[model samples]
Target: MNTLSSYKHDYGPLPSEVSSAIKPIYEELSKEELLERCAGGFTQNNTESLNQLIWKITSKILPAGSKIVEIAAFVAAGTFNEGVLDLLLFMHGMDLMLARNSHEYA
Candidate 1:
């Protein structure tokens, strides 16, 4: 999970222009907004970790032939289970291209 970053007040000051533009917006964010950003960051990290693990297992299982289809299957499963379309279309397209290339090469 992500945590809010804290800075010391005694740190050197930013340039005047950067301070003017950033300080107000930084101060205006509520505690809830900060927590929400942290939660989103944690979710993204977990998803990436899970993707890597799945990919490692898939690669081992199919050292030959097309791993693209296997990756697409995992992505589509994620979309069906979690309803996030994250990269599913791209994976599917790669699988199609791989199929086409294998057929052409043969």
Candidate 2:
């Protein structure tokens, strides 16, 4: 498995601005606030936002070289379940493609 140091080299460190912004938001957050932010959706709803948030958070935690399937498997290790993992992998793939397309035009 790749180390965190290697991952940082591949993706570049989080920008200082991003780190600064996120730090205060993270620090001031209660457990519920944190969960809500991470969960990413209308309150009391399970929707595409949840999946999108899962992808976003996983992208941060996962090594740059890690496959979406591998990340999905890791996420599925707990209460997330295999079916949900598969869906997440698919969503991650879609997000990656969208990102790539956007970058190509920029």
Candidate 3:
């Protein structure tokens, strides 16, 4: 089995599609706002908020299955948007709905 040390993670710049989507939003922000956002990056997405957001989504939206919900919690944590947690909430909700359908039908 593959181990953590052997895993090669591709930590590169965001894909063009993602960058493109955010370009408009980025441009719309004032220079001062952008600077403030940059300064706040380090303090934002704190451990407590991340934990609570993930817990609420995974525990409430995911199916009753332990494994699926656990995986969902982990995945949702990474993709969770500090600026807009609800967006990823919808994403987790979609995943849960899909999992529920497949799981129930299977």
Candidate 4:
């Protein structure tokens, strides 16, 4: 297993592709807007919002089951960083949990 340091050396930051994908939703927003939406404390609503956005984008381009992994690979290749992989995994897990909760509520 790659250590976090190795991962960091492997992947420096988010990739252009991932940034492009996420940009449509976030890029237009001002810095303050982003802070408003994502700041303060973690909440179910915020988590759901982030999950929904990622799911919407990932579903469009990735096959299923491996969307996050594929995205991580892309990020790793594009940025030579692995922390991005961890971030994607965490986001994916949040998306899954949000989806499950939405289903349960429905």
TM-score of each: 0.26, 0.20, 0.26, 0.21
- Tens digit of lDDT per residue, candidate 2, span 7-44? 54556478978988897777777567567776765454
Computed on alpha carbons, the lDDT of every model, listed in order, comes to 0.60, 0.56, 0.63, 0.55
- Write candidate 1's Cα lDDT for 47-91 as tens digits: 676666556546555554566657656775565455544444555
Best of the candidates, TM-score: 3
Sequence-dependent TM-score of model 4: 0.21
Q: Regarding TM-score, does 2 or 4 come out ahead?
A: 4
Off by over 4 Å in 1: 1-12, 30-106
Runs of candidate 3 with Cα error greater than 4 angstroms are: 1-45, 61-63, 81-106
What candidate 4 gets wrong by more than 4 Å, as runs, is: 1-44, 60-62, 67-106
Per-residue CA lDDT of candidate 4, range 30-98, in tens? 467666876766535744654554555455565667857566445444333343344445556667544
Candidate 2 TM-score to native: 0.20
lDDT of 3 by residue, 43-62 (tens): 45567676776667665654
Model 3 CA lDDT for position 35 = 71
lDDT of 4 at 35: 68
TM-score, model 1 to reference: 0.26
